[model samples]
Target: MNSVLIIDDDRSVRSLLRSILQKKGFKTRECADGTSGLEETVGYRPDIVLLDLLLPDMHGLEVLDKLQKAPVTRAIPVIVLTGSTDQENRLSALRSGAVDYIEKPFVAEEVTLRVTTQLRIHDLIKSLQTAVQGLEDDLKAAGTIQRALVPSEVPAGIEDEIRWIYLPSSSVGGDIFDIIPLNDHSYLVYVLDVSGHGVNAALISVMVHRFIEDFRSSRPGDREPFSLKEFMRSLDRNFQFERFETYMTATCVIADLQKGEIEVSNAGNPFPLLLERKYTQRLDRDNNGAIGFGMVKGSTSVHKISEETRLFLFTDGIVDVRTCEGTRLGEKTIADLAESTRHMELDDAFSKYQALLGESLPGAQTSFEDDVTFVAIQF
Candidate 1:
């Protein structure tokens, strides 16, 4: 039979509870004060404790605090029995780690039902913890594999200096950006963000990177410069065959500094920002396209690449971050900040923007409900 400890100052209440629990086939122990209850809890090691809020010697909450602190009594499920049904009292009881809260006048059947349910949930939680530990081990292995797939160092032939910042909200992130040098003077700069977070998203990102590498390698003949429109079409076709529900938002900017030309195409991503002469402009005006890699079946709207001195491609995580006042840090803010810091180095501009965000939204917490990635190139 399960043992239960009932603690209350009222004699009548304690008697009623002891009788009811005894009749229900539970071994019952009763105490009249909080101090005695705390001592008895440690010595008796009862399976469950029915604790009251009001007591003569010490407050019931204090008894609960002691039980929580004692490792032996901490796992003994506690159900707070209180006369008050105020929201604050209920929240306090719950926050103090009571398994459940029961009002003083709770029905006998309801109390028994709640206790049984809590025991069952406790068992379930233990099982789930074991399962999760196994899953965590698997995830660690997956993270290793994913990290290995990403290029350790920028390819040697890429003429442009590339600097990247990648942060995964989870063990792995879905955001991926790479600078693949096609030749000595020009390179393929692409930034992609998968729709979701975690292992699935990271796996999809790796697959996308492999596909991009394969596509570039398979192309025959002299490296002819293709328009941004052609690149987007190829991506759409590739996604059509994969048939995966996961969609990828990407911005691919092919920069040829020797020719002083940049071809950019974006599919449902934040517009790439450009800076020059203390001015910032959004390179792609038409943000009206669907994400590629199975988000949509057909070709999406494309924006013709325009010339710019410095180009930046980023994920929505940066712009959609909320300020301390709950306002979104939108594209306008980013553009303005970029323009203001145009004279600074590309790396300096990024650092300044980060500081500006932190300063502007003081006390705002990080992890803005999404992953953020920024890729900048100066030509």
Candidate 2:
């Protein structure tokens, strides 16, 4: 039988929990307060912990914190028990690392269901971890290839400072950003996000990078300006016959600083938010439609890109990130952050925006749901 540790200040509550769990064929260990609960958790190493929020020696949250910090107890699932029955408490408990939170006056069946679900999830995680560990060598090689594809430094003659933040939701993700300079006066800045996660998505990202490089090489002299429409048409034609089932959404912005103008284009990508000294606006697209690549056989309509403006391009991972309360951190929040930090340097502005998002959603883990990548450039 799986072992469980029940921590509550009240003797009656502990006894009731012990009876229920024992009847369900689980070995139960009881602790009278938070202090002893923490010690027992480390010593006994229970598969699950039933912890009460209010305790005599210390608060349940504090006990949770300690348990999470202790290497021996961190992986064990904890379910918080509270009398408050408030949404805030529930959200806080979940964010603090509790697998689930149960309000007082709980049903036996509900508790059993939650406990069983968590245990199953824990087992699944362990299995996945073992499988991944077996592929450690392959993963290392893949990491090397991925890093090589990323530009170590922004291209020369690009006056604007470029900064990027990338977090792959899995071991690998499809979000990619690149800043390639065609010449001293012209540059191509693009951010692309593939529709999925993992190895397949990452492989697609590499293919996109290779295609972009080939497209750049095919273009003629730097003296004559490159046409954004012509480039998109060529790209659409090149991949029109490919057999790949996956499709990619991209936002490509071409800028000619010498002419003080830019041309913005998108293919099913989130609108690139522009942050000016005084205001913020999203670059316009054609009917708000997505531009499809890879297996999709369609021509993407190119829009006029604006110049003398800073461009902020990102994947849905960043824009649609959620808080523990299930509140979305939408495009508006990003726009506000960019506008508020417009006067600051590019790197500083990026850091401030990331920090603000982190503060708004507090948790031990600081990662978005999907692969997140952002690139900002000022002309």
Candidate 3:
């Protein structure tokens, strides 16, 4: 049964309320003063509190304050009992955090009705909180599954250094990535970004991740030497963005360990950066729009590393970060940042880059502008 706590200094009032509440089938507790009432409130952890404004020891408002301060009793519903029906007393009680107000010399019907009303409200709030918590739990579980799909390290026997970062804009996000080792000499890495954030975008991102994961597991064209062009075309056809209103962009980079070459197929995303000892240059361009727009063959860009090379691949979130100086860190600025990192190892380089972006703008890391994701490969 739902519990009720009555706190009043008058013996007759407490007895009357207890009788009425017992007849209504509520479990009730009583205290005659504010100090004892507070102790009862904390001990009973009642669903609702009947708090009388006039008390002998401590002010009734002080009791309410104690209840609000304690974590255990703070959430209980409170109905303030007052001697006057004046607006001043009512406002004061409300401002002090009472859920409802009751005038003394109470009518039997009105008292029962008000108590039932507050109890109903309390039950409704608790139901909503439970539903919200369920949703949060589901999102956390889905996020864990998505992270598991994203490989933290490159697959075995792929002889190269690989590092990546994924910072979602919220508890769950729309950025997804993976590194699949094709053979001893070649491996595949991809970065994808949906146009928006939140549940719909996150769901779409999971779908995209699953599609790529299934394709990789099936060993796409292992025997026939799968073309990056064919792979992207397949993804485009499978997703068929014309049916859905949401748009997305993606880049798939194939890095060959033995040949020291990179091939890319992109859909309206940023170009990969080739970072060397002295300079940084963005690799080939794709004339096509985003993936859902029927982008076809030869949007591929090829780059062969001359000396020691570190390739930078990222979603627009990294570049789109707006700084405290009010400058939107765009593609050019990201390239410049990567260029400066040539002296550091790829892991240190990209981590420091993310750190700088966060420090450059207050609350940037904790409250992201978007889903910031990047993959760095050293060859």
- Write down the TM-score of every candidate: 0.63, 0.60, 0.92
Candidate 2 C-alpha lDDT tens digits along 1-379 = 8888999988888888888788899899999998889989988999999999888998888899899888889999999998765677667778989999877776888778888899999999989998888787676577568767877788777877678777777667788878888877778887777778878878878887898888787775575556666666555555442445566677777777666766777666677887655567776545223334433333334333344467888878887778656888788888877888787777788898767657655567655678888788766
Clashes of 1: 0
Best by TM-score: 3
Ranking by lDDT: 3, 2, 1
**What is the TM-score of candidate 2?**
0.60
Give residue 210's lDDT in candidate 1 (0 to 100): 87
Query: RMSDs, each prediction?
Result: 6.8, 11.2, 2.3
In model 2, the worst 10-residue window by lDDT is 295-304
Stretches > 4 Å off in candidate 3 = 85-90, 220-222
Ten contiguous residues with the weakest lDDT in model 3:
358-367
Single out the weakest 10-residue window by summed lDDT for candidate 1.
Answer: 297-306
Error of 3 at 189 (Å): 0.8
Local accuracy of candidate 1 as per-residue lDDT tens digits, 274-323: 66664666766654365654443333232223333667788887888777
lDDT of 3 by residue, 106-223 (tens): 8877778999998898889999999999999998887787677778667888767888878888877888888877766788888999878877788889899888767776775457
Instruction: Show pairs that collide, candidate 1.
Output: none
Error (Å) of candidate 3 at residue 153 is: 2.4
Candidate 3 similarity to native, TM-score? 0.92
